[model samples]
Target: MSRYTRYGGGDPLAPPVDLAEALDAIGQEVMAGYSPERAMQEFLRRGGRDQAGLDDLARRVAEKRRELLARNNLDGTLQEVRELLDTAVLEERKQLARDVTMDDGDRAFREMQLEGLPPSTAAAVSELASYDWTSQEARAAYEQIKDLLGREVLDQRFAGMKQALENATDEDRAAVNEMLRDLNELLEKHRLGDDTEQEFRDFMDKHGDFFPEDPQTIEELMDALAARSAAAQRMMNSMSAEQRAELMQLSQQAFGSPELMQQLSRMDDNLRALRPGEDWSGSEEFGGDEGLGLGDGTGALQDLADLDALAEQLSQSYGGARMDDVDLDRLARQLGDDAAVDARTLAELERALRESGYLKRGSDGELRLSPRAMRELGKALLRDVATRLTSRQGQRDVRQSGAAGERSGATRQWAFGDTEPWDVPRTIGNAVRRTAGEGGVSGRVRIHVDDIEVQETEARTQAAVALLVDTSFSMAMDGRWVPMKRTALALHSLIRSRFRGDDLQLISFGRAARTMEIEELTALDARWDKGTNLHHALLLANRHFRKHPNAQPVLLVVTDGEPTSHLEPHGEVYFEYPPHPLTIAYAVRELDNAGRLGAQVTFFRLGEDPGLARFVDSMAKRVDGRVVAPELDDLGAAVVGSYLGSRAPSGQADYRDWFGGRGFWAG
Candidate 1:
């Protein structure tokens, strides 16, 4: 057996929305100092590789509105009536000319009646309603004018009535009048809050054939009626004063009865009372040669209203805006299903990002990136670094799996340059066995170099690492701010994930220096103060090193300028331009202190200023460290490789050798 269900209606073959792409883009912006909320909104506004964004949808809607207004005018009904009246008069004159049997006085009277008609089409139509025509074709044509006017007036409020009621009989007209009476009564009851669902259902059952929209409830019915009525009113307002006056007079003669107009007036009043929020007062100006009948003109106004609504929803600029506020059904009706699909995808992406725990509010109630988000962003940055390294190193494998200094449960024969602890029990056992196998066992078994054994250890070293980044305004002005953040995040990810035993500290120095977490550092915006305080940064790094006394100290400094600020003994910051002698002395003294702490330091210079380079080289020489001036794009790889090289044992291959000498200073 098989089962079936109604189709939900979209392209079944379209690819699912790519949330990863959105998340990555949002993460990048967040790292560049955008709040999590703003970053996600920016992503939605820009959309993904294959999806249309909000801005694109808004532009298309505006174009459609402009086209509608420019291509139509409101004179179709009046023009049609005038043509019919001219044909009737021409046929009557021809009949009078051929009728020799008629009396001369009667022919003259008929000619005079045709010649003395009013200038306005509606007035002429009303005056001719009582005239006795001599020609059969003339009488039929004159009658059709009233019929056409009635259908057009009805079509304005009830769409499709002009086509549906063409050449309708008196019974058809009576049924329509009865339907209008019942509809007005229902709306009046609804407005006074005295209507019930059963009454509405009964009303629909009586006249349901007239409403093809198949509204299921009273409110839906009211909404549809009210919207059509409002569009009709706006269409009338868009017409010139002369057109408006003519149409108003012609409407009173609809179906050759004044009763129809009175019922329609009552319906309009009830709808306005019930649905006051509709755009009843709105109007537009149309300047074109193509004339639209009352029905078509109302439809154009409705389209314009829909486009305006879509533009507002797509803007998402109002207070407390959300993607869910967009009306997908309305958008599809106006701009097709593909545009609706694009907007739906964007809304889903936004909802997923907000609910995925990737963003959280800090204590201050401002949105911030969560730790999980930081890890994700860090992983992406690390992958980019790996790709850069692979390309620059000619496809060499530069993957490091574990930390150093953890002991494995195995023993190996000692070799030159081995720093592992000696396996004393294994060495003694090997000596005893060797002596027993060679000859009789001596009272004192001698241990020989061949019998020496050392404990084999896994690479699980515990090291204290300090990554200091320059955060001066110059960094942002020179396009180095984002790269600096990326480099720090890459190294931070590497240590936290691959080398769990390593301790990492991120410190930023501008007018001063302070320690921060990875998320904090990534979200830190550049300050505009004018100082590069390497002295303050070194003080913080030395403190971190002292805290992790037993771990190997590794310091990586990234800067583009010489020292311009120092801390005084009284705990105040002293800043000066062009490197004050006292500031340089203070910075150099801190470097010497870091050297005494046994830190293997590396200076990753950012720019090509000769004076700054010379000063950094001198500082590196004092600490027996290395200085690498890599390209901005390669900064992450250089810092990460230097860190790995610092952790390598005395005789093992390091990241520098693995990277194939890609501008790393091998000290």
Candidate 2:
């Protein structure tokens, strides 16, 4: 046997939404200085590779609305009334011409009355109400006009009433009148807060056939009635003044009596009082030759209302907006189930991102990328960098593992901060022995905390790394701010995940320098300050190196300008442009200090300025380090490669081999 599930609620066969893609896109925007919430919203607005975005949905909604307005006009009922009146008059003239047995005076009088009837269809119908029609066909046609008018008026408020009341008898009309009276009474009681569930149920029991919507409560019933009533009013508003006037006059002649009109008017008033939120005064412009009857016109207006609501939902621009706020059922009704599916998928994507704990609110009550989110984003960046590195230089032996050195023929109990490879066989054996000695009977051997073991290895030296990035206005102006942040994140991920023993410090400098966490640095906005301040950045790097005196010191500097600022002895930043001699001297002096501490320096040149190139070359030569000139796309790969090369225990020889004379080094 087979069972079926709804197609678009969510298809089990469909591939899962890619949250990594969303986080990666959002992280890039955040790195470019967007807040986390805005970045997420941007990603959702732009959608993913296989889905439609909010903007596309909104465009479709607007087009649908335009199509509705261009396909309809509101003169159908009036046209029908005029046609009936003309036919009745023609039939009456034929009957008079054929009545040779009647007196000449009487025949002539009837002919004159027919010829001198009022021009307006409503007026003519009213004038002929008392005239004794000579033809049976003419009399029936005249009566049909009253029935049609009555049904059309009711249909405008109660959908399908026009078709249901066709050729109805007096008993049917009387039953409809009774239903209307009961409905009005119920609405009045509801307005006064005196209606009960049983009373509503009793009304539904008597008139359930009239309302196909099967509203379960008084409020639901009122909402249904008010919405339709408002649509009917809007249809009237969209008509010309003459059309509205004719409709008003003709409505009084419905059912050949004024009682139906009186009851309908009372019901409309009660509906307005109960559902005051309905847009009863709104109107729309419809330009088309095809006419819509009262019922169809009201439906078109309701469609317009739905389309307007859809437009607002798809905008997602209101305060505290969420994708869940979109009504999927209404969207399906207007745009089809495919659109609802698209909207539902977007909502699920947003909910998943929020519930996955990747984005978290900080102490300041603003959304920020959590550490887990940073790790995922960084991993994605690192993978891209690795792909670029492989394509450019061919595959190299750059496998990253926790254990750093060659393993010794010895095992030790595991502890915190251990990076050695796990001894799985020995650990399992210890678990089995410990469990058996503790009198534990089990089908599967259980591993306890005290039974875990790790393979011993020779000690490998760890590196103290400092990455200083330029954050002056020029970096942002040159379209390098995001790439700089990406490079930092990729390097940080590599160090944290692969080289667990290494110490990493991130420092950013514009007019001054300060140490920053990776998250803070990634989200730092660019400052339009007028300084490079490499001297201050280097001072911070050297201090970090001093803190880890026993580890290899590696400094990576990314900048596009010469030194234009320096920190004075009083800790105040002094800035100057045009290569201030004192600033240059201060920067060079710090470079000497970094060299004295045996720090391996690498200057990643960002632009093709001849002066900057010359200065970076001179500086790299002064420290016996290297300089790399790479495009923005390769920034992450270049920084990661430099770090890997410098952190080798065999010193500059291993660093040179890591590049394999690939000409990555500019000097």
Candidate 3:
């Protein structure tokens, strides 16, 4: 309820502050191909809906379109059609026109000058003719047409179309020639097939500059629009992927390159500014600039959260509870069919994933994790957990013990051959006692090495942890996995960013137990119910920790299932639910090894009265570990405490995690 995408007043044509712009900024930046919805969200977060210039442009375009709709047989705004035609022309031609043209209308209408007519007159004709239908001479001949039109009106009329068309396509450029033919056909009929004066006027206003008055046909109008988009498409196809990406990057930074990206960027605002569903009435300069080479249309998923708006509304019913009931399918369903994604959106997401390192395609054409993406997911969790704990506490990396380098302190009586800070009183007393006693120092009162034992700092014990999460359907079955996943990400982020010195491994177990690279976390769509192999997960985790003895080894297992799978040496898996004895035994094999390695096994169960309690309790005693009950939002917090130690509630000896890890999730 806090967020609504307003139809805000804005400069529809200003250079977009979009994902490309975000990526160019310093620090962690949004990558290219970010979800359009996310892109807009981030843009708004940084302050969008603020450009008056674009708003003015949109209004003007819309107004011009309205005017055209009132008079011409055209289909779109002046700027829209001009922009479309401009797309048909070479970039070199656009530059030439911009160089010569001054006014926005002139620059936009310059495409009409393709006929080689004077740019000024051609632009004017394109603008006026786009909305009305009448021969230059015939219309003028109607003096009462003059009386009907008014002196100011006649003056506004464009110069002549033939004057430009004769030379514009004299060379018969295949594309331009085809366009000319279509225009000629549309003009030959009634007001471009517009039966009503209003429709005719709209058509004229939208395409008067380009379409001939002689041919009035609806097919022609459609053809013209298609040709323009086609031309743009062709232009894109002509370039290599690298070239296109490079050009896109450069164009997005239109302040510098201004031609390609800047022009494309303006298209959206320009189109919006026009007559909307009507014809081209806006001035020529309006839509053609594009500002940046990126296209308009806001992409299908421009505001993805919008697709989830209904779900968000439904979620509000949860008030302070039922948060765990949130469903991704419901979120997806929130979108109406028209706004749903297609091939284009998928390609965009894939590109973004590749750029973000979330999806990598290997030689075998399979999805794999890139190192950077993997690191990012882990880093995300690490940061989340660290922040959660540190707000109320201090950095808890680790503390060294007195085992390494013991410090020296003197005992009472000084003995010979000992290094110590001599205690005068104790030495004197010892001498006096010797004079008066049976058991005392004889001649020289000196401290001996045996009596003066130096205290050494205990080597700070390091903990090597392997986090095993159940990826089986059952975990998500209880609708707890996302929080679990987030918990994992938060924990990973915390360790990497805050506890830079800790050793951590991330592993998820389902039918198979294997270590996952960090990049795979976000894109993971685990098969929820394939099988929950708690035994295999633990075994793999234990094997990983066995290599590191210097560290206090531990297994942080996040699951909501009992043992279900174990492997025979031959590589086949044996899976049985309801606590199969073989699976239980296999789990014990690893739990027992963990106990022998002196590593504790901390169990994290996320269900009410979990059936696996007895099995867990037994394992806990075997390794002297503990289990935590996770509240929905407390998953990350609980997991964090496993590595970071916590103090007792009682005002007694403060038990720290030893290493400076925030026991954020300390249970």
lDDT of 2 by residue, 364-399 (tens): 887888999999888778777766765664434432
Best lDDT goes to which candidate? 2
Top TM-score: which candidate number? 2
lDDT of each: 0.85, 0.86, 0.46
Candidate 1 TM-score versus the reference: 0.83
lDDT of 1 by residue, 521-623 (tens): 8887767888999999999999999999999999999999999999998989999998899999999999999999999999999899999999999999999
How much lDDT does candidate 1 score? 0.85
Candidate 3 Cα lDDT to native:
0.46
Runs in model 3 deviating more than 4 A are: 1-384, 390-459, 497-501, 646-667
RMSD of each: 9.2, 6.6, 22.0
Per-prediction TM-score to the true structure, in the order listed? 0.83, 0.85, 0.42
User: 70-96, model 3: which lDDT tens digit per residue?
Assistant: 443211222332343344334435454
